[model samples]
Target: MELRNDPQSHYALNACIDKYYGSKGLPCLPYGGVQIRTSVIDGQIHEDVYEKVYFVARKYFIKYSIPIDTKNCFAMLSFAIGPNYVPMTWLVTEENESKFRVDNTTEAVVHNLAMLDEYLAGRLI
Candidate 1:
């Protein structure tokens, strides 16, 4: 993944999640995007990965009263801005949400990262 010019913001955000939830930080993909691995939960998958993340983020925003948009998913989480350029948001999949509830945005992110890490490490079946 292409490194961001300023990683501090993303780092800070991850730090926030770690502080609240415990480390399971997000991952930076080759194209500078973020993704979380999830499995079937209650026999339902949200379908749209980006949308699901946005929805969860919206819930977080409403709960925390933070001003953020689902549009900035990549920038805020991965520090990688897309060509179109939009607000910062995080992307999550329905399968993932099934495994972990997004009651806490930071914790959700951390859980996502931990899941991804496990998948990469071949710890997840």
Candidate 2:
């Protein structure tokens, strides 16, 4: 399924995949935007084609020794704006969260990237 917001914030490190999303055909990532891109994950096939995304996240989990439900179809990436800044996280969806069981409130909240940009500007929450 499609990710919720900023999609290109993720780049699967040279992993063999995308039988599910066959070459986005973009020469490269676009400039200075939210980095939103799309990939597909379908359980109907009961196989994974997004292992790059999944495994990269797994790497972080292992490094931090954090517990993650690999069965869950999302990865939460935390980042910082600059030095002395608090972390902010963006949740990348490997599948539709509205379809899967989700934590922290049981459902996905629809949000627009542009609007979120306006909201988070400098406030940095």
Candidate 3:
């Protein structure tokens, strides 16, 4: 089933992303999921991060026997972390741009990317 179409699965994926991303005190279940924005300069880096995060999420889902399609889940994950599909103004202004880059480069983000790198490289699997 598509994660975006099923409310339960959508919330589950959102919670999984949020918890793994180290977001605290945020809504446990966001109906439409959360959006993480990035500046133009950091767009590629955040894309790479989301790729890693998707693989990590896939691994966890398989371990837990979650019956979600890989492609669909990855697409949903992309929408959640990618700077697209939201208001362009979210990343347009110079002030928000810097903050967006900073938010995307947090220590937690770096660590998740690194860990997923190892996992993908057959070291963490």
TM-score of 2: 0.21
- How many clashing pairs does model 1 include? 5
Candidate 1 clashing pairs?
1-30, 72-87, 72-88, 72-89, 73-89
Local error of candidate 2 at 124, Å?
8.4
Off by over 4 Å in 3: 1-4, 23-125
Taking the tens digit of each residue's C-alpha lDDT, what string does model 2 give over 6-64?
12312221111222113433122212222222334563423211211122211221000
- Write model 3 residue lDDT over 2-29, tens digit each, in one string: 2333456545554455565445332222
| Model 1 poorest ten-residue lDDT run | 58-67
Report residue 53 deviation for candidate 3 (angstroms): 11
Supply the TM-score for candidate 3.
0.23
Query: In candidate 3, residue 80 scores what lDDT?
Result: 30
In lDDT terms, which candidate is top? 1
Q: What is candidate 1's local distance difference test score? A: 0.33
Q: Is candidate 1 or candidate 3 better by TM-score?
A: 1
How far residue 62's Cα lies from its native spot in candidate 3, in Å, is: 20
Q: Distance from true position, residue 17, model 2, in Å?
A: 18
Candidate 2: which pairs clash? 1-41, 7-36, 8-35
